[model samples]
Target: MEVLINLTLNGLATGMLIFLLAAGLTLIFGLMDVLNFAHGGLFAWGAYSGTWIYTSTGSFFAGIAGAILTGLILGLATEKWIIKPVYGNHIQQILITLGLMLVLSEMLKVVWGPNQISASPPSYLAGSWELGNIIIIKYRVFIIAVGLMVFALVQYVLKSTKIGLVVRAGVMDKEMVQSLGINIQKIFMMVFMVGAAMAALGGVLLAPYSGVIYAEMGLEFAILAFIVVVIGGMGSFPGSILAAVLVGLSGSFMAYYVPSLSLAVNMLLMSAVLIFRPQGLFGLKG
Candidate 1:
């Protein structure tokens, strides 16, 4: 039972990290209708930059803050320069984003060097707590806390704030929202920046969790993030959280009890959902 609980906690932590990444990916797709392959590039940049800050300052919190800022800046640049021109054209968007992805990725290697860097949890998060027969890792707990916080905050913003309402409305019908005297383009920039920050934050958090950061790691995880986004339903924040948790848990348990099937687990889950409901588990249909 204790082992089961430990695995569950681990899975939840992993899910939360993925949730951070997928949340931004979904929101970008949902509101902007831009398929951004460069999202992963932002993720890699976050890990590299955050790790550098953390190492230099010897402060994990500072690392996280710096990483988020890096994401915001990159997001702004990409939106203004690369993505702006490609809007409304799927082929152009795809080509440009893919190109941007390559450019950003190479820039990571140039700036950070082409080597994997190791990351460790902060001192306060380095140990484990024992509860009767169970052991809970502090970093995992911290991740879960942060993830839930992000979820709650986003939910509140979406349900209660004017900006949130606009985003939600835009998701449903962007043209209709634009017709109502709103600057949809400005909103797109804000949403894109926020999403980029989230992805960068995810990368920073994941760096220590995985113990090593590398340029190529972003693409590997991006694949999983994309799967989670598709499974959860495009444009549904709640759906992304739920689907991420499910994928995280499945991956965790499968790795322990069914190693060979671990890689196939997510694909199978996605396949099942697609076969039954092509729009995805929570995606709003067009």
Candidate 2:
């Protein structure tokens, strides 16, 4: 029972990280109708920049804030300069984003060196607490807390705010939203920035979880994020959360029990979802 509890918590934390990335990707795709392969690059840059800031300032919170700001700036720049031009053309968007992904990823190595850097959890979040037969890692709990907070915040923004209404409307019909006097282009930029910030947050949190930050790690996790997005249903924020939790829990338990099957489990899960529900568990049919 204790083991199960521990695994569940661990899984939830991992799920939250993946959720952050998928949330951004799905929203961008749904709202802007853009397939952003460069999303992963934003993540990698966040990790690199956040870690650097944390090390320089010796403040973990500052690191997170810095990463978010960096993500917003980069996202705005990319959306305006790179993504905006490729709108309405899937092939061009893909090519441009894929190329941007490479450039952003390479820039990380150039700025932070190609070698992997070890990142330790903050002292306050380090170590574990024991509860009877169960032991829980502090950092894992922190990650879970942060993830839930982010989820709640995003939910509130989507459900309660006027901007959220515009976003939802745009997602349903961009032309109508624009016809209603809303600046669809400006909304697009805002959504892109929000998504980028989420991805950056994920990257910053992930650095301590994996204990190291590297350039290629972005691509690896981006694959998982894409899977979670597909399984959860693109453009469905709640769907992304559900899918991420499923993937995280599966990976956590499978890694411990099945061992050899851990790597294949996510793919199998994705395939199963694709077979049974091509629109994803929560995705709306177009």
Candidate 3:
């Protein structure tokens, strides 16, 4: 029972991390209809920048803020300079973003050196709690809490706020939103920036969880983020979280019970979902 609980906690923690990354990707793809393969680059930058700031200043929150700021700047630059030209062209978006991904990775190596950087949780978050025979890691719990809060906050913004109404309406009929004297382009930029910030937040949090951050890590996790987006359905926020949790749990359990298939399990799950429900578990059919 303790083992099960531990695994569940681990899975939830992992899922939350992935959700942070996927949430933004889904929003960008859904609202902007752009395939942003370079989103992972933003994630990597967050981890690198945040870890640096954390280590230098001995303040974890400062690191997070720095990372978020980095993401917002990068997001704006990418959207305005690179993505704006390639809008409505998936092929160009794919090619250009992929190139950007490589550029971002190389820039990380140049700025941070070629070695992987180690990250540790702050003193307050470094310990574990004991409950009878069951032990729970504080850092893991912290991650879960943060993830849930972010989800709730974003959900409220999307569902209750006027901007959220505009975003949703734009997704359904961008032409109509534009026709109503609203600057849909500005909305797109805002969404993209928010998405990038979320990805950066995920990256910073993941640094301590994984114990190290590397330049190539972005590409690897980006693949998983894409997988989660696909499994949950493109442009579906609720679907992204649900799918992220499913993937996280499955990976955690599979790693313990079926080590050989741990990596392959995600692909299998995605395939099964695709075969049965092409639109994804929570995605609407186009």
Number of the predicted model whose lDDT against the real structure is largest: 3
Model 3 Cα lDDT, one tens digit per residue, 172-225: 778999999999999999999999999999999999999999999999889989
Which residue pairs in model 2 clash with each other? none
lDDT of 1 by residue, 144-259 (tens): 99999999998999999999999999999999999999999999999999999999999999999999998998887788888898899888899999999999999999999999
Instruction: Between candidates 1 and 3, name the one with more favorable TM-score.
Output: 3
Model 2 C-alpha lDDT per residue in residues 16-118, reported as the tens digit of each score: 9999899999999889888789999999888989999988899999999999999999999999999998789999999999999999999998988999998
What's the TM for model 1? 0.98
> Lowest summed-lDDT stretch of 10 residues in model 2?
277-286
The positional error of residue 155 in candidate 3, measured at the CA in angstroms, is 0.1
The true-versus-predicted C-alpha distance at residue 214 of model 3, in Å, is 0.6
Residue 221 in model 2: lDDT: 83
| TM-score (C-alpha) between model 2 and the true structure | 0.98
- Local distance difference test values of all predictions, in order: 0.92, 0.92, 0.93
